[model samples]
Target: MSLLLEEISIKNEHSFRSKIDVLPHIEVPWHHHPEFELIYIEKSRGTLVVGDCIDNFNDGDLLFIGPDTPHIMKNEDSYYQKKSDLRAIAWVVHFKEDSFGKEFFLLPEMSRIRKFLTKSFQGVRISGSSKYKIIQHLKTLHSAEYSQRILTLLQILQVLAQSEDLEYLASDNFVETFQQRSNQKLYQIYEYVSKNFQKKIELEEAAKIANLSKTAFCRFFKSKTKKTFSAFLNEMRINYAKKLLVEGRLTVAQIAYECGFNSPSYFNKTFKSTTGKSPLQLKGEK
Candidate 1:
C-alpha cells in the first residue's frame, strides 16, 4: 500500500518558496523534486532517509537537500508518544537553480558558496553556532519584506558556505538510486526494519514488507542501503544499545539482550566497531 504524504507551501513573495509541514505518523512515500530544500526541524525525532544515507534525526536539526534528490522522513513509533500526534515542525525552503541567477553563485568570488551547493546535493546537516544563526535568519525571513527577504536568503547561504561542521549524509552511489522512483519500496523496507529490528527479522519477512521475493528484496535492500540485511540489523541493534548505554540504566549484558543480540561478546564487537569504543568505555566517556 502507498504511504500517506503531505506537502504545504508557506506564503512567500520572493523567488523561493517557504513551507511549514507536519508529517503524519506514516512512512513518507519515496519522491523527489527539482527544487533545492532547506529544512529546519523544530520538534520530533526519526530516521531521515536522504538518498542512500540512513541516520537518526532529533529535534532542532537542520538539513539542506539538493535539487531532485529522493528523500523521505520516516516516523515510526519512536518518534511520538501517541499515534495521532504530530511528529515534527519543519521550515522548508525550495528554490530553483536560476532563482538567484547563475552569475550569483558562479562569480569568481563565490567559490565557497558554489562548493557548498555542490556538496549539498548529497545531503548535509548544519550544526554548531551556524545553526543558531540560520534559525534566527529563518525567523526574520518569515516577517521581512520582499527586498529584506532576499537579503535573508543570501545571509542563510553565506552562513552555509562558511560552516565547518557540515556533514555529508549520502554515499557515492546515492545520486543514481536517488533518481529512480517507481514505487515506495524503499520507504516500506525502512519502516519495517525500524519497527521490527529489535527482534529477529528474517529475509523472508522483510521481503514481505516490500511484497517482493526474498532474492529480489535482498538485492534491492543492498543496492539502496549499501549494506546487507544482517549488517543493517546489527547497526539498528547497536543504535539501541547506545541509547541504553547513555541512559545509564542498564548493564552491558542487559542492553545486549534488550537489543536482540544473541551474545554479549558479539554485541561488544559490533558496538566497538560501530562506535570505536567498548560499551564500558562509552558509558565512562559519557
Candidate 2:
C-alpha cells in the first residue's frame, strides 16, 4: 500500500491563509509538501518517520519538519482501541518561506526564526525544558489572534533555535523525493518488515514483497535506506528490547526471546555490539 498524504487548507476573509491544523487521531500517511511544518503532539504515542529516520514518539513530543520532507505518524494498536483514551492531539502549522516577502528571513530581527527553519530540513526533535516551552506556545497560538499569534509563533521558533536538547533525525544525505510511484515498493517493504521484524525474516520473503530477486532487493533496499536488511532488523529488535527493558517487567532471557532472538547468548552479543551494554546492564541502567 502507498502512503497517503493530506493537504491542509485554511481560509479567511482577507487571504486564503493556511491556518494550522489541530488534528486528533489522524494517521498521516508518508507524504511531503512545500510548506514548512511545526507539529506539537500532545497525548499521543506512535512511530514517526521523518526523511530517512524512523523512531517512536510519546506524548508531548514536538517535531519540526521542513518543506518536502516525507513523513507520517503510525498510531499503535492501543490508539484505536478506545478513541477517547487515545487522546492524540497535534498542532500543525504550515507556512511558506516566501509568504511574508522576498528577504523576510534576511532581516536581523528574524534571524532566530530563519535559523530554526533552516535547521528544520535536518528534522529537529525537541525534548526536556524546551519541549514544555514549545507546547505552551503552541497552545497560545491556537487561541491568540493578530499580533499575539505572530509573536507567539516567533517565540516558539526562537526557543527551538536555542534549544540544546534538540536532536536531528534525518540522515546526512537526506534527499527529498516526492515520487509517490517510487514509494509503493518502499512502503510495501516497510510494512512487511515492521510487522514481521519480531521473528526471523528470510531474504526470500522480503525479496518477494519488493517483487525482485534477493540480490536485486538487497541492493535496492541498501541504496534507499543505507542499511542492510539484517542490520535494519537487528536495530529494530534492539530498539524493542530497550523498550521492554525500560518497562521493567521482563527478564533478560525473556526479553531476548520476546524480541525474537534465537538464543539468549546471541541476543546478549548483539545487544552489547549495538548498545555497548549487556542486556542485564541495560535493564539495570534504566
Candidate 3:
C-alpha cells in the first residue's frame, strides 16, 4: 500500500520523541516519517516492509530507519483478532540528525556517529551484542527520567556507531530512489499495485492508474523506483508470500497460487532467486 506521511508527535520537554507500545497488534500501517527512527521490537512476529525490502521480524529485532524512509511493521492478522490474546510490544525512538544542534555531528568526537548516521540512510538492522545493548538502553529508558532518557539514548548511539554487527536492509539502488518519490503519482501507483497485485496486473492498467500512457508510465516508474512495474509487482507478491510462509499455515503450492504465481515450479524458482532460499527453507527460518 502507499505509505502515508506520518507526523510524529514529540513533547516540548523532550529533545527527541519516543513511544513504548503494547497492543494486540502493530497497527501503525504502511507509513513514513521524516525523523530517523530506531525501533526495538521486544515481542512480535510479522512482516517488515522497508523501502523495496521485505523481510520477517520477530522478538528482539532492532531496526533503524533514516529520515524520509518508508517502512512499516505489519503483524499477523491473528494478532488483531478480538478473541486473541497475542500482542506486539515495541520501543521506538525518533530524532532528526540535527536534533541536538545543527553543528553537533560536525564536531570532532562525533566522527563515528556522523558516519553511522550517513550509513543509516538505507535503513539498518542491528545484530549480535549491539542489538542486546540497544535493548538494554531501551528497557532502562522505560522508567528513566527525562534527563536520563536522553543520556541513555546518546550512549545507545555510541554503541551503535562502534558495533560490528549490522546489516543494511535496503539496497543501494533502491535507496537512490527515495528522494524521487515525493511526487504524489508514485503513491497512487504504489497503492494500486499493492491492492491489486494478487490479481493479474497489466502494465497498461498500471499506466491508467498513474494517469499516463503505457510508455510514459513505464519510463516514469523505472526512473523513480529503479525497478520496472513487473519487477515491483513480483517483489510485492513475494513479500506477501514470505509472510504466509512465516505463518506456516499453508503449503508451498497453495502459497504459490495465493500469491499469483501460475505454477509451483515457477514460484519455487522465483522465490529461490529473489530470496536465495527455496520456499521450504524460508519456512524453516521462520
In candidate 1, what are the lDDT values of residues 1-286, reduced to their tens digit?
Answer: 3333435344544687876776655345655677788989887677676765556677899999987666777665755555565656778788777777867778888788788887788899999999999999998887777788778988999999999969887655556554566547865675566556667778898899888898998898898868788887787677667767887898999989888888899999999998899999988866
Q: RMSD in Å for candidate 1, one decimal?
A: 4.4
Give per-residue CA lDDT, model 2, range 106-212, as digits (tens).
89988877877876886888899998998888878777776776678778878987889798886554443323336567766765665566688899999999999
Q: Which of 1 and 3 is the better model by lDDT?
A: 3
Which ten residues in a row are the worst by lDDT in model 2? 13-22
Across 1-286, the per-residue lDDT of candidate 3 in tens digits comes to: 4568898888888878878888888887667777989998889988776766667788989999888776767787788788999989889999988888999989999999889988887889999999998888888876778689878988989998999999887667667766665666776676566556668888888898888999999899988877788888888788889888999999999999988888889989989988899999999998
The total of clashing pairs for model 1 equals: 0
Misplaced by over 4 Å in model 3 are 194-199, 236-252, 269-286
Task: Assess each prediction's global lDDT (C-alpha) against the native.
Answer: 0.76, 0.74, 0.83
Candidate ordering by lDDT (highest first)? 3, 1, 2
Model 1 TM-score is: 0.72
Root-mean-square deviation of every model: 4.4, 3.8, 3.0
Error of 2 at 203 (Å): 1.8
Better of 1 and 2 by lDDT: 1
